[model samples]
Target chain A: MLDPQIIIAGVLNGLLAGGIYVLVAVGLTLIYGVLHIINFAHGSLLMLAMYAVFFLWRLAGLDPYVSLPLVTAGAFAVGFVLYRLVIGRFSHGKDENILLITLGVSIVADNLALLFFGGDTQTIDVPYAGDIIQVGAAFLPLPKVISCGAALLICLVLGLFMTRTDTGKAIRAVARERQGARLVGIDVEHVFAVSYGIGIACLGAAACLLMPTFYVTPQSGYAFVLVAFTIVVLGGMGSFLGAAVGGFLIGITESLGGLFLGEQLGQIGISLIFILILLLKPTGLFGSRA
Target chain B: MRHLALAAALLAAVVYPLLVPNYLATVGMLMFFTAFIGQSWNISGGFAGQTSFGHAAFFGVGAYTSTILQVTYGWNPWLAWPAAMAMGGLVGAGIAVLSFRAGLRGSYFALITLAFAEVFRIAANSASITRGGLGMLIKADQRPINFQFKDQIWIYYLAFALCLVSLLIAWWLTRSRFGARLVAIRENEDAARALGIDVFTEKVKVLALSGAMCAAGGTFYAQKYLYIDPNIAFGIDKSVEMLLVTMVGGAGTIFGPLIGSIALTTINELTRAAASVFPALKNVQPLSLIVYGAMLVLIVARLPDGFASLLGRRRHA
Candidate 1:
């Protein structure tokens, strides 16, 4: 018998968490779908995006919400360049090689961030930082709601882009068969770059949106990445729809578990869920076994 | 000749700790423990190609089981060690059965292990008996039955013996039929299955064996230090250190984790010492991590078979 008010609060938090999970897992899945690499640096890119929002807000007095577009654009450019120069070389090899290369990229990014920023927590100064909205018996934070909304919008837009656009078709073609896509005269390289760029852009958008609510730090991405990995696995590796649903499920479970079992146990609950899902469904909920 | 090599290696291991200063002795002990754990990891990860990144689950399970039994039930520390090792094996088998049944192999297998470790860490952090993040600290005093010792040499010997046991187990497994099956499965699971190898059974067996060894390492670690914290017990860093060492030295080869562990541990000690001396260089600590990461990339890129293969090729040539 949970309190109705507490339940609503949990739902809100879960929704917000799910939004972030979707954002993180979508990027991971997108990269994996095209390149077949988990892209361990995906989390590092998110950290970079968080820093971008923080600096933009801190240095220029720009609201993180307003700077989201620029961050997305910047992430796209960096991701494009990274794929072209580094990831491209590792793309055509044993999968383990990609894992190692991405791991290297992640290590470099994390250490570089640590070197530059020092290993301390920094946050963007958001207006209405302490403000809350009372919904009937439940209080909801404005920042989380906004972030979730933005996340949903991004997911929708990305879904449309993937389904409707000519470039999106080419990307899907490559994902299905790289050799076949090449045979069809499609620029597989460009598709790889664009897919990676879009993936990073999603992370960039998430970072800017999240900056208002969470603290930005070098190691902050580790927990986020781990959680996102769980969600991605639950959703089925490379399934966009699965990532979205898995995100919400994880968020709800995390928030509800936090409320019932306490914060520390809540974290363990998520990890247990991952193990349980992995042990139960090898193909994942949405993953199609070809 | 084999016996002679063993005697020589044992002599070097025993005497080196005594020759080194106390600080260096401690570092050597740490390296020995790391090597043991890395060898344990190598059994399942390297030999079986499971890539389990969550040996910390077994490590923590061992530490907690023994620590709690010794402190609460007033069990003898020596008795608790076997209990811990057994518990580790059981848990390892459980994890193997669960994960393998679900088709979790390779990277997915690694992910599951990491998830389990995280779960264990969180559980330890929350459980009241384990002191719930305040951690467990044994009274630091010299008592033989208590398994507490003031002299670094005693702890050094104990860790050294544990390392020997671990290495022996790894070697024994390598020469066993189980080891052959594991190698076959690692090379190609489908082909192995076709060739009448019980792939799942071999994987689970290797995972359990590795888990037991790692757990024993954890138990000894807790006894020596007389302190057990959830963060250290179920740390991702500990798991990574094991993997990095094995990968660097050579996977799927006898004595690879031994070499990797010693080399990496020494490097870690140097990095930590350097970082402390040059407080201005806080980021210097990450230099080792960066190098380790780069090494992983290079090994995967150029030397997929690891350092052992390079040595073997040189010998053959």
Candidate 2:
């Protein structure tokens, strides 16, 4: 019923949106792959990071790009200390306990944002927000295009860091075989804190990318939590490539779904996909373990 | 001694409503209603060790089903209530079969339930039958047969009665054979399976039961408020609230949800009163929730048994 050109445009739009999702999912999958627990607070933390970006811009007149590194560093420190102080200390190596703790953490974080940030939906006004980039049948916004490119570059750099660095190797080791890593004298606890830090750092980068196009509300974090989990599961938990691909696929689904199914029902596809993946093949694209 | 305590508590509840103002009576109703729903969650998540993150799916389904039947089809509210429970049970069974069949449990199960609730919410948002995002309103008629009441105290009694029924069901679970099997599954699923327990069937059964109970609570809520919307019907907040109460009180204990509800409602009311007094303390609602969040974390970490444990720590622990 639709023109091929229109369809193409929708797909392009979805892919651009999916870039931010990939960055968020990367953090989620890393937490999942290493900690072996679903970080229920991922969205809330991302929300906190978005607030940081908003304040940095609102208070200091700094552009999001300029504040990315500072916000990312701050997020990483918070994540590390949070794990050491509450999560690791309380979890006692139980997956379910960790899940509950994170659920509690997310509740706290979301409400904390509500308490401080108020419930108003805030968006940044970048000068180039209205600028457009034409690709084939699609005309993408400049901010989206920039965010997409930056997201991909960040993922690539993170991949290299994971594959090349000793700490990365140590993190991988811990993820693969925790006891073996411990036997080799890897400070497993330190690695956990670092991995959590890196995961939250990804969220920091994502917050900067998202602020240009998206609005920030206390509820925004809760909205992304499900989408991030869906993408992470779709990509195969802990698989960077899977997360990236899943991000694009989900993006396309969202774009097309909105185009065809209407805005209200378009979100049903994501929830259904999450259920189906969990039911039929939870390992996802690159995962061997469910 | 425990029986005497419960008897005294029951007597106090019956008379306390008579002594309280209308506003306080309404608060009592809310506390009991919350406890009933929380008990519904405790049945699956606590007693059966099947933690669901989307009990709202069942609650919403129940609320919508009864409302649609009564408003659209002209059924009695009493009849619609049972129909709602049946619909809720069917949905619970469907989710359970799909999930448990695929060997999902723990966090995976929790996530899937959340997704199902989302699906229901989005569908409800778009569907014409549900009136879209504008929400559906029940015609207000101050008649007992129609399930509407002119007097607030009567609704309070109804909520109180529902809480009592839920408490009885929980008490039965504490002593019944079905309860023992569910506890086994919660403590260790593989071992229960090894011992010839039909883990799959039992889980589906418990989920269905929990769903029915939650749905009944939903109908009660709709009747009290006379409104149902996509978000109000199938929101994550309701799910979290149910889990919070049960966990804060004591997950597996029969009285856990009741205790948790009392504690939370008291805090909620106190904060509300404080906010009203301060005028400048605009975030009292979220402030109280922050305390709840803190309490949830502390309870999960240091006091897993919840406040219920405080009364009977040696007996249960």
Candidate 3:
């Protein structure tokens, strides 16, 4: 017989994991949707943001939560520059070339982080790091709860912003049909930059919010990125609703898998699930193409 | 002209081990092996245009199979090598059959492969047969069954020979019908499919063959090192290095990966040597990665066809 509290706790954890997935997955999908290039280095950008938060905390003594805006800005600037200098040059090009370029960016960023920060995992010892909230018979860590809250807030805000803003509408236009958007006097280049910027900012925010709950390391991005990719694929690339919904599904599946199976098995199980999803639905559950 | 080029390449490879310093000899061996991996990658990724990111799965399969056989059954490492390679190829074939059957190509195919590699890595880490994370260590130091080397020179020589054989195979593959189909699929899969070419089957066949070739490389790698660990065998860095070699030198050409390997490996060795003196540079072991990334960007931006195309042009000129 399974513990009822364990199930509840798993659901909560899943919801949190799902929220983070949505944030990372959205960025990946958006870039892929607009540019038709899968940003293999998406995780590296997330890593950069985590490090940004680390430095802010260590140097400026700013709280991780308080530094969200700063990290968001930093991520945006990085994305904008990358688009203007690197991606802008390759815009409207072959997809493989773009994929390779993004992969290169990922490699550069990962190694740079490794070089400067060393291959060590660092964490912020926040005041609430040790705090936990007891839910009936189950206990939830406070940091995870906060991370989940931040993830939800970020997604909701970004979703609203994308749907509400004219810039956002242009971005959507670009994603849905590039040639059509270009003919309508929409600055496709600027739209590309803004969408890419928003996507990077989303990942950046995720990295910062996750710092309190998880340690930051140069190699950490690979793990998260893999999961995020799985979520993106499962959620259907470029589908915002799919990303949000897929995040929770994967998170819950992961939590339940982790609790029932061992930790290692849980991770493997998710990977297997990712492969299955690809096989069953190449366009994804909510993919636009299919 | 091709024969002359091949002869020249063989000459360089044969003499390389003798002329290079010990550290360089080791790097040379790695470069050769990596070149082999890259060439094999090109069969599927470049020629077939599959772009599998999970090649480490095949590599790990080869290493683990060889290691387990050598350790448990006391099989001669040489005899077990072919068997180990076959297992990896078989797995690759299985993956191809499944993935390509669904018409999953390009990024979708690459993601699936990546996931499979991660799955294999995690499973290997937890499996008792792999000794879990402890991995497999040789019981004897220098017995023929042990596959342990008393000197690095021997391993270098063996790796060099394997490299030559792999290059020859890669050359033959490019001229073969299967290779032609792979290239056709790579250039335009939909057109190939329309013309009665079984694109899915061709992709799987090439991927399987490439997996086998990579597995052969992995078998030798494990046997030479006489140690096999999940992380080392299934590392993403290995996959990246293979891609770097192909991308840097030329993807479709026969000797592209080989040239890329030599150039990149030499630069890496140079950086490593510099690191020994500077110390700070040593901490940044991944600086080469940045260079690799930059080179990738440059290649995509300037010459999408790769450096080999430049050589081809010069030849035609």
Candidate 4:
């Protein structure tokens, strides 16, 4: 049997990674809930946010943590404009068209990053970049611990907002039934824009949290986006709480999978689970039948 | 008038190869190969209304299987073609069974397919037989029996034949009951099921056929390219290229894949040529992808029916 400390460390690492997945997956589920379009470009939007944070850190000498709100706000504005200008035109179009459009957006965003950043992998260097915290027998990296906490806190705040705020209720109303929402005098289009913006805003926040610990590359979002997809599907689509739980589950799976299956096969393990879950329960663990 | 048009087109196809330079012939070969792949994709995607984003899985299986067989066992590459198709079909059937049994539709199905491809790619990367990222290189031999051609013309002819075969199959499908059933499923699955259509079985069968055809294209690709790498064989970009070619031509139509492939290949060649001629553009990143993305956006926004629809309108006029 493995050492208790090793297992605990792995679990901690998985939880940290799961926190990031939760944030990204929640955003994806939110967009899916309201817009009913699987935004293939969600990862690309996160890529852009990473770049934004990188530039802020490099040029303005701001720490990634300090720049979180700024990046989130910036991403929100961009997402809102993008929806109004491009996505709004195809709100009622075929699912395939919406899928293609978002894919197009992804390709454009990825190539644009390549053109501008020249494909070099960059990372932000903060004072606590090498710091660690001790938890009994297990040691936790400070960055991971902090980011994971922040992610959970954000999810909690989002949960409260969803249940408490009128706009949040309106968004939910639209998601449940668009026609009924419109009949009740909800501005469905505005809600869509807001939902998309919030979804992207989550990506921006995730970028800031992730930058300190992870390398930022033009293609970095591709793998993370895939992981987020698995998480969203496993947790149940359109369920925020499910995404959070699913995030932790995938995180733990990846960490333990890496520990046992070797580094490369760890990814395969996640994919296998994703496929099995999809085949066994298309509705996901917490999702209702569509 | 239709017969005359067909005769003229056939004559041009037969004679143009003899007249064009080898480089242009190579481009023509690529266009046709892409069209073949696109048409195969259309069987499941357009006709059956099942969008797959992981076709590269089937494609990569074909390329890797044939290449590995030839390299390891000195097997005739021609023999490897059927093996590739069988492998592709098996994988396709597996995916179809699992996904359909679970009732995965639309994006869920697409994502699952992507996951499978990614798994395959990662497996290829780690497996020693696949050479683990160094890639497999086939020796250049101009023997006809080895499926290697001394001249590019033979390759062009082979690709043209394959394209014609795929087109004929697609055309036959349009006139068959299976094709009609596929169309019914595409338009409305629940309604078709209510009408006594075995939705699950039909989808799996169509997917298997599509996978087999795509696998054949992969074998042809490996034989021509003389190299097999995980990235080249299993890349998501390859899958996207297939989808783009089919969609731009007009999904669900016999000639759509052909037109889309020709248009996309032309655009790609033109961009490369322009990039080479301009010194300033040399150091700059290649603009082909940006153009592709822009084209996708423009097409989705303004020309969802694709360029094939424009041709259809002119024919009616």
Candidate 5:
């Protein structure tokens, strides 16, 4: 018999988890939309950003919250340079080439982190790391609530920027029809670099948000990236709004699964949902058929 | 001349373990095992153009099935191998049916396979039957019936035979109508479908074959290593390694995966040797992986057609 309080707590935790998933999924979707590359290295880039925030917190005594801008900027530069130097060369290549290249990048990034960070799990001790807020029978951790709020705000800002800003519109246009956007005088290459930068910036922001709640390791990005992939697929690939909705759904599913099915089965539950969705609704709940 | 070269190569492979030390033979066996995996992956990825990132699902299923049978039921190891292959084929068919029926293609299909593999890994980690993260270990018995031998050469020969069989299958594909259809699908699925080919059936068939072959490789791995763990059998690294070897050698070609396995294994062995020589390099635990990553980037950027094409170009010249 499940307690009402447990259900409520689970739902709240799921929402928080969903918020982070949304950020990561959106970053992946954005990269896919503009570059037509799945960017397997997306998670690895987030891992690097997480390390950056960790280092900043450890060395400068800076809060992860305070280090958000710096991490995001650094991630953007890394993504931008990665595109110009390596990914750009394969822009016109086959899909497998792009996949392999990104996979390779991920391998390099992870091993480099392993070399420096020594495979130990690292976590930040934020002031609110252990604080909690109570609502009736339910309690939410302060860090989760803050991260959830920040994720929403970032999503909203990204949405507005995509819709309202000229550069954002150009990015959307390129995503919608690359040849048309090119014909209309959009600097395809510049837009690509910027889009990649923005995609990576999203991961950077997510890393900072995540550092308070989750442990960081050289391999941590991989698991999160897998979850993000599931969310993206569930939300419908390449659809921004779908990613947001899908993230919460996966988050809730995971929490409920853990409560009902045990910890390992909870992870299995997410994968099952992912496979079922791919089988039954390849277009996703909100995405139009490709 | 080509036939003579092929015969010479086969002779060399058979004589290799006899001449080399135990360590070198072990490395050669591992290289051949990788070649088997890469070749199996090539059926779906190179020929059919269904680049899966989750071949580990099949590999794990095969590995776990055989190991579980041998360890728990006291079954002969040779008997478990066929059963493992069958289980691998079933899983492969199931994935192919579900994905192809849903019209999933390209990246969507790839991710779904990965999810399935992850699901299997997690399941293995949780299920008591798999003994969870503690893993399963086969008792050391130097009996041929148990698929265990005291001499490392037996395992090497077995691995070599498996690699040869996989290569033959690949070669047969290149000469068969089914192979042509697969190539057509790879070139353009829509066009192939428009040409009256049963694209779904073809994809499913190839995937099943690929899955079974990969599972066979897994069974071989279990028999040689005498251990089966979720991480070793179902990890993303296994999947990526299959892709890396196949792509580096040339995905669709018969010799591509074999060549890639040899090259990659050599690189890995060299790096490990270097690490032992240099105290500083020893701290970098996964230096070979970094090298592999770098090689993948370079190959994709410079030799998209793989190293096999280089040989083709030379012959033409």
Candidate 6:
């Protein structure tokens, strides 16, 4: 039952899956760091973005990779506007209210997709979808390898944007000290919207990458969102490095857990980790003291 | 004057089922049943301000406990009901101690509860004692002694009575010292502790009470539907439903859950009926949910007191 080759293959597959998970967690951690509220709509928004990718492929002849930039930008705009219009205006300065409001947003967004798109599992068939790449004992799908690489590239770019740019510095300042940022003449609200946009933009890219290998339903958002949240929590809320590393860890857990526990009970590993981390250390691995 | 109004309302409620058709009675039953469960949520979430996202955990425990007791052990379901509540209370207190001892608050608490519920869901799905996704079905013993009624009107009355009981609990919470302590904790836990209140014990107590009520609701639900499954027993849907009714109704107020339940059930039935009628409109089930979701946002933003505030009475929730 414990084949080293099979375990190595599982590890490899988990790493491949982790790339996109990192992208998703990065978005969530960014939002939580800045806003101090869990965005419940994160999953629903991802689902909607996946639908966009699906429609782009179905309506036009655009491949998932080709449409990446478009969807990412569009997602950014959506996030920015959503913050300005709904989340910022209505939260009443309470984190709990924002959580509930986001919960509502997710409900609305999910049902809207159900109403408009119908409940169907959609996937894109890129011509090279079946292509494979071999490494060590593992045989990986070509698309998965490409997505993994692309996802990492996007994360590196995002990290650079966060650390190297003046806007990035200002966003960080706002995250660290909102009042202090305002005192220093930074536009706090603008920084907020920008951060939120950048966060959601990650999801857009994730959606594009995910379309090749994974199927999207109204539920894909929820499925990925929970895993992303686990990654974020495990990594430490708001820690980019944590998100990156935690993503791979969770991906491996899912793969290995399924190997040992069977499909039905395998999912428990993630939930258990989430519960334990929160109970033992709410700050997570990289988060500051709670 | 208030007492007279209350008497008149109770009078109307007593006569309502008799006057209405059996279909309408069932709808009323659903409204009251939801109100009962929603009120249980209101106790901890609304009144005590300890919002949970996994009340379904307790709900499932009650459901499975009663079903197993009746089906496997041959224990009467009526006897199993209180036993289920005991189990729910124990689970509730256990969760409270684990979380509160670690000082989990706000979203942390909410998310932990969700995780716990998920754990239960997975356990139910995998454990053979639960029959592992096959679900359990109650025997069709349609006699009053078995807690299953033939006419369905008795069940309606049972639901209505349950809702009334929950309302009384809410009313007591608003007036009792225990309730006051919970409210103080909600307003400011530090202040409550400063005022010589044991915040931890109070929170645990309220959660136990809320859990017991919720568990009773679960048993009622299992008996009503005559089926219990992992998904049905511990689903996020029930958690969402409990939260939605309380939040959309009035949260802390005595009448909030009842009002919210009626509004929710009405919207649900209306949208489903509309979809059935138009056929061209095809699916309004999502439409109703959309409406509920939008209402949640709007209420959180503009009407924090919910529709209960529109009653033109100045009462503290």
Q: How far is each candidate from the true structure, as Cα RMSD in Å?
A: 2.4, 1.1, 1.8, 1.9, 1.6, 1.6
lDDT of 3 by residue, B145-238 (tens): 4566777777777777777777777778778887788788888888888888988778778878889988987888787777888888887877
Tens-digit lDDT string for candidate 4 (A1-113): 88878988999899998998899999999999889888888988999999999999999999999999999899989999999988887545668778888888888888888
Error of 2 at B172 (Å): 0.6
What are the models' TM-scores? Answer: 0.94, 0.99, 0.96, 0.96, 0.97, 0.97
Q: What is the lDDT for B58 in model 6?
A: 91
Q: Which is the leading candidate under lDDT?
A: 2
Query: What's the TM for model 5?
Result: 0.97
Q: For residues B111-190, could you state the per-residue lDDT of candidate 2 as single tens digits?
A: 99999999999999999999988888999998999999999888998999999999899999999999999999999999
Model 3 clashing-pair count: 1
**Residues forming the 10-long window of minimal summed lDDT in candidate 3 chain A:** A90-99
Candidate 1 per-residue lDDT, tens place, B1-317, comes to: 65897799889888997788898898888888888888888888888887876889899889988999988888888899889999999999998998888776667777788888888899899998898898898666588777877787888888787778877777777899888888899888999999999888888888888888888988888988789999999987788778888888888787788788777777777778888998876677577777777777677666776777877787678
State which candidate has the highest DockQ. Answer: 2
| Chain A TM-score of each candidate structure, as shown | 0.95, 0.98, 0.95, 0.97, 0.97, 0.98
lDDT (Cα) of model 6: 0.90
Q: Chain B alone: TM-score in each candidate?
A: 0.93, 0.98, 0.93, 0.96, 0.97, 0.97
lDDT of 2 at B207: 96
What interface Cα RMSD is found for model 3?
A: 1.3
CAPRI quality band, candidate 5: medium
lDDT of each structure? Answer: 0.83, 0.92, 0.83, 0.88, 0.89, 0.90
Give per-residue CA lDDT, model 6, range A1-290, as digits (tens): 59899999988888999998999999999999997869888999999999999999999989999999999999999999999999888876556678789989988998899889999888999999999889977899999999999999999998898899999999899999999999999998899889889889999999999999989887667667678888888989888889999999998999898988999899999999998888898778888857
Better of 2 and 5 by lDDT: 2
Native interface contacts retained, candidate 1 = 0.56
**Taking the tens digit of each residue's C-alpha lDDT, what string does model 1 give over A217-249?**
887766777888878878988899889999999
lDDT of 6 by residue, B142-219 (tens): 998888999998999899899999999999998999999999998898999999999999999999999999999999
| Candidate 3 DockQ, CA atoms | 0.74
